[model samples]
Target: MKKTIAGVDIPDGVMAQAATDLIRGTESELMFHHALRAFLFAALTGYRENLTFDAQLLYVGAMFHNVGLNAKYERSPYRFEVDGANAARDFLRRHGVAEREIEEVWVGIALHTTPGIPEHLSALVALISAGVQMDVRGARYDEFTAHQRDEIVQAYPRESGFKKKLIEAYAHGMEHRPETTFGTVNADVLDRWDPNYRRLNFCGLVLGSDWPN
Candidate 1:
């Protein structure tokens, strides 16, 4: 079924349908809801900010941004972000989308987990980062008026079990590939859940270096 959020419509179509179907079929219910919410939240961000972007591209990014955590790519050696990005890129390529647009969506999904960078790349990338953050951490949450947020969430209800389920999915996806999680937000998951995980600290570099000063 098609849906709308903050006035932007997400129709079931070439760019969105296949990826949506795959995730819905393979991932958990919480994950599927989260993907839909990511698109709505990102679209809401773009709508509220009057940001110009390819809605189809943004939807593609949102729909497949977490493919890494799905059973299809969960065990990939790359970060789940990269896995998701590759999935989006391939999907776009198969549909004869231009190389440039495919790259845009790819980078957006791959870098969505890296903070402070995507917002500066371009509109689609920025929106993808913002949308993922909006879904996960409520970044820039104040922009959405209460009514808007209610409408989006109501359209795709975030079940009470989402937080824990999403977290577990991330951890399980990257548990065997912990190296991929380093330097991205996924690191935090490993830091908390995977017992054998170790977090990197740059302070060691500063302390170990001999300062000429």
Candidate 2:
């Protein structure tokens, strides 16, 4: 049966079900629930903002946004966000979804970790970012009513010490390719967890470039 939470109907189509199965099999219980909560929160934000979005696409984006954190991608060269985005792209393509919608999901997942950029891109991207921030950092917490918040959390409870676990997940995913964290918030996770992590300075890179000044 399809479940509705916070006035949003969870997408239960074959693609949606397949996406749920993929994430359920790939991620931990905590991460799987986090993805589900992210979807619910994104849908709720779409309603409050009067923004129309494809629920299925948003669900897929949310489900695959963190899949890069899995052990399989530990050696991936790209940023974990891009890895997740590419995974979504491949999945959507195999499902015969349109190219435009696939790109929308790609951008949404790719920029999910980028704080300010995704919100300005598109309704799909903005909602994904908003949902992630709201779930992880309590951004826009007051926008949702107390009852709404309680209901969503009740449906997908945040595990104990979710913040720490999430940080560890980020660290574990990106630790191998520390260079990918440059110029994004993901760097902060490595700095905290990996003692060998040395953050690249943007200004230093700019001035140290091989250009005749």
- lDDT of each prediction vs. the true structure? 0.83, 0.93
Off by over 4 Å in 2: none
On TM-score, the candidate that comes out on top is 2
Worst 10 residues of 1 by lDDT: 2-11
lDDT of 1 by residue, 167-199 (tens): 888888888888777678888998889787887
Whole-model alpha-carbon lDDT for candidate 1: 0.83
Model 2 over residues 1-213: C-alpha lDDT tens digits? 878998989999999999999999989999999999998999999999899899999999999999888999977999999989999999999999999999999999999988879878889999988888899889999999999999998999998999999999889889999999998899999999999899999999989999979
Cα error, residue 124 of model 1, in Å, equals: 0.2
- Show how many residue pairs clash in every candidate, following the order shown: 0, 0
Local error of candidate 1 at residue 3 (angstroms):
3.4
